[model samples]
Target: MKIRKNTLLIMMILLTVTFMFANTKNVSAKVTFNKTSKSITKGKNYTIKISGVKSKNIKKVKLKYNKKIIKVKKLRKNKYRITGKKKGKTTLKATVKYLLFDYTPAVKTIKCKINVKNKAAKKKKTNNKKNNDSEENIKPEIDWGENNIDKLIAQIEQSKTYKGTLYKLNDYTVFNKGEDGGEDQYGLITSPFYSTIDWYSKKDYDKIMNEVKRIVKESKITDDMIDEEKAYRIGRYMVKHIDYDYSVYGQRIYETLFDKKTVCAGYSVTYALICRYIGIDCDFVHTSGFYIDGQNMNHAWNYIKLGDYYYVVDLTDAYCGQKYDITGPFFRESGYVDSKQMSYIDEKYKTSDYTKDHKVDNISHYMRCKKNGDMSQTLTDSELYNLPE
Candidate 1:
């Protein structure tokens, strides 16, 4: 009896130790900066990269530092370029809010100390910030072959299969076209002819473009129709023909054309394509962080510029109507518009109501293509298309 009691006490001690070890979980995550300290000449740029966070997981990245010591800008998800502005010392505090386990959002911050030296401040310092923004110096790692913003926007505008791909894509750095010509990490280009699916997708691309024109003709969209009427008709026609298929390549235009189904990206790409054939001013605006049906994710939508203000035309959100019943920000109305009454992109965004807003940091996108999303909604002229004031 004495021996058994001693053995039992030992076993209990060992079990308690094991449980304590198991409880040591990394809740905040291990955030690290490449350089803990650095010294650089004024006007020279120093790169500081953060580790322990993936690009997709990053919700929002912010830098806290004195602007007088350096001018910093985000080079990518994990990197920052800091140019010394004057002879001084400052610390770069980078805070990153990222999703944990791809579900829960968490934040962590790391700091880097820096010392700047040189007579760089001798030049007129009053307009340095403006000058830095206005000037474009091509760098090797993230090169935009074209430096002029206006010219680049014009060039891309002319290249879309339709006008709103611009709105759907909206300056997501991939559109910035670094030296590799807009290739993303997934080895895919924004266009079928660009890369990834290049040669094999040509026929598919041709098929979709031809189909877009045919669909417009079938809709009886006359040249005399106002832009709003034409857009409403074409948008409804797109929703009627295509069902929502949440899958890989759902963001690509050709995929939606061939499959007759796609996620929000596919809708944006197709809508942009159709608008191109019909002659309309449109583009795509995307957010890395968004919410749909109670889940946080990324989303894309169509935007149109009408005079002084920008209007939205999210056909994807319209999937909420009498057809696709996904129960997202998409209302029963023909398309997405906020209370501001511009147009419906995502009514949940830019609204005064925080009750439904799921904005976590800056992360806005879908975690997965909703596999079971259904669609039967169509514009059918029953919905109203309110043009921008």
Candidate 2:
């Protein structure tokens, strides 16, 4: 009986130990990048590694980067070499996928900031004392936070060297009213218009603005209209009024507001300004997409925020009836979503959601059947504007 009791006690102890062992969690391998951040010369190769990961345990290591801008090469086991071909800041991510051994598959990731500097440009900057002296007088450029956009627009309009491009406005006080410390690209001035003409003078600027206001007044756009309603009316107005042609003053503010014959730049700029006039936060989106002839070209458009979602307005494409049927910013083909225009949604404006639910069916057929189609259905006050019922 004593022997039986001893055996039973030993069995109970063994069972308790087995239960605890079965419930124990698997230990994870500590993975870390060799360096948290790095700055390297452009066109030079640099080594990056995941220190704590075992080569045998790793199924494979993958490096994610902008292939167009940066290049990566895998060297020995658990090591990678990265080279930035362009002068900019890009994030390098190394994902170490582990091989499951008596446990669920676990993965580890390490990220390192890679800043590629142009060595020659830096040296030139150091040598240029005149530029440094003048920079103190020059105000800094900003990405956002200027409350008076109308005043900024007026200032840009009045500049004799406006250069149709937003480049000059990047440094002006009214435009860059705030500080930006995010990335180099966060400092660039962006606009939907592509013309490179000068702003002319205050007389021309006032005339153009007065004409714009007259059109808005004629269209009867008021504060009572929601953002979507305002945008729809403005887009429709541009399509009806503006012709796809060049003017003597060029395809820009003067041509768009006065002559009524302008290209994508004029159409997009007019739409953006009209929306802004009616208290809608709208901006220009520069994109590259297929033109009417199936040829890829740089296009200009506008993006507006309605309710909580953001949608794109390609007035040029819509006016030509090329992209009038697509639901959002993408074209639908064979039940799949395809990007029609590559907009500035990457780390610049944070408009990535421009591609979500952006598909509509029978685009080519619809456009072929109905040239210069009426897109009143697509830009309805209820559907596009999200009016409160």
Candidate 3:
């Protein structure tokens, strides 16, 4: 009886150990980059494969390269693959969570070094050699029409202006007074624009412009598209790429082009510049509005001429509530303004006169104007008169 009892106890211990091992081994997975032994060139694409154990019911297999999520693909029941573009020392890790148990988690990690060599870098080096060899065979041609005219205009505009003083204007004061001094008014100044243009040489500017042109051309984007869908798309794109920095009160269109940092004015000016570059008639309009938090302030936005009517767009306003507090001065309070209230301004002044003072209560008044078949009465003469001088 004692022997039988001891035997039973040993069997129970063995079973417990086996169960623990099974959970630890089978519940976890691993992935490794094959070329982990050496540094690879930058910009070279490489694949890392994950293997060992069943990943059939895995919830997520996140492959991170220097903390950035690389593209992960499932190969089979227990295999996965990851592709990465950046070249540097990257640590790859695999995380698998069992779907059946929400709390149960498994993780396996491996460190790998990737040195990606850019093919374009090598090609550029070779091209420079070839250009040197054929130096006498090529003649430099000056593009006086477009290049010179643009440079001269930029120089003149930049030379004549200063980084105009920016003062925070009270919404109520501007709303009732009909005009804030131009110096204190919110607008993109010529100096900053010129400075931005000068910051990028003709070559660099051409490259950026060409990049935009390529995107437009390759996508087969047209003027009609710009007038309709493209404008909004550009707005969204700018908002996504450019971030608002409250530290910098304002940014010029050129700065936004090069530095890619901007505030509301930057978004509107950049939009207008790109539109004009693409032969679309667009204009910058100044408006004052408090963002959702109700801190009434001066602001700027844009108007895009599409067909016979002008469409109002405030990229800043559209991006206000996202990723940041809309109540902050950097993000104006105007995003809450409804479309009906927006329609109160005359089409010409929609971009400029739509101020923060016009609350939701004004919607009915604007709607009445639209219903009366009198576009003239849409905006009060006083509203237009109060716009920035």
Candidate 4:
């Protein structure tokens, strides 16, 4: 088993060359951190992501950071989660490996600078601003048609298209005597808010719709939000800012937007407008009468189509001018519909809901997910968006 010194030296040289070649094979890819620096409160986590490569494209990742200042966890091959252990700064360094364009294994280094803030300091500033906002929003001075709200609405409406006939002057059963001297029914459609129809439209048919949509389009809607999130956020915003004033244009959404005040009808129509703009399937829900607090009165709300079923949402009842509690939104308020009773079909105004007094009046053009019991449960994002094709 003895080998010559010259032979051993030659084998050593070959091994050294092979090691150098292997080290030289891997090249750096042009990778950069998604955000060079991110700021969050203490004990909060920030996403560690890199640009120019997706999580799926990554093959492997190795992270190095100070454990005393932060804790890093790998969410995916390329994506990592960094939690701030203390209120300070930490540099999270990652060596990511991915397949290059030619399918060669490439490595790149990226760093994310994390700055964590003290929760106490953050909460102080938030509270100060909130107190000031409460004072201003408590009695907001809104123009109750100073510059002509209808005109402003008409401008926006002129550029938009609508579904169904935008008819005006909704008339109900008004018995008129015919030439035969008998009573003749002349009213067209029986609606949930036939009594409040006078208060519904602002002026004419088109202009009335103009104000409702104008506010929604002009409101603060972001692209990153899902349909459910958008709907709930907008509804919550109105509840927080809008004052309930039934004095002028209370039923129309114009007053809700401009005057910063409106009734139940305004809330419904405004939300419906929001849903329409966001590409969410929504309905004009009306309730002839539903018993509430020992009174049987009419109400108006919306029924939006999410996934396979439509859920009733009464935004007015959700908050009632109080703080916005998301648990009472949409499906949470309507309760849950079992599979056996999934008869959302039938052209009923079921979208408006609250139809104990008049069961047949809550007819929606589409199917309505029948609500039973008082279920305080809400649906998750997966259930809302993932629909059966």
Candidates in order, TM-scores: namely 0.35, 0.38, 0.33, 0.37
* Clash count, predicted structure 2: 0
For candidate 3, write residues 199-269 as lDDT tens digits. 23335544555545543444333332224434544555566667876666547655675676778777776
User: Residue 208's C-alpha lDDT in candidate 3?
Assistant: 53
Instruction: Report the lDDT tens digits of candidate 4 across residue range 5-71.
Output: 8889989999988875565453343477778888876676666557676556788777787788888
**Local error of candidate 4 at residue 235 (angstroms):** 1.2
What root-mean-square deviation over C-alphas does model 1 reach? Answer: 21.1
lDDT of each: 0.53, 0.53, 0.44, 0.52
Better of 1 and 4 by lDDT: 1
**lDDT tens digits by residue: candidate 2, 1-389:** 99999999999999988865554323344566778788877676676767665556777777787775678766445656677688888888877777544444667677888888875552332434356443224433323322233434434432223322223332211222222442211111124222222344434545665676677666655443445555666676677677776334565666777777787777766676667655565556555444658754666766655543345567776667643332333211222213544432323333344344322223332232244463322333224333221
lDDT ranking of the models: 1, 2, 4, 3
For model 4, the superposed segments whose C-alpha errors exceed 4 Å read: 1-219, 245-249, 289-296, 321-333, 336-347, 350-389
Which model, 2 or 3, shows the larger lDDT?
A: 2
Clashes of each: 30, 0, 15, 12
Model 3, TM vs. native? 0.33
Ranking the candidates on TM-score from highest down gives: 2, 4, 1, 3
Worst 10 residues of 4 by lDDT: 168-177
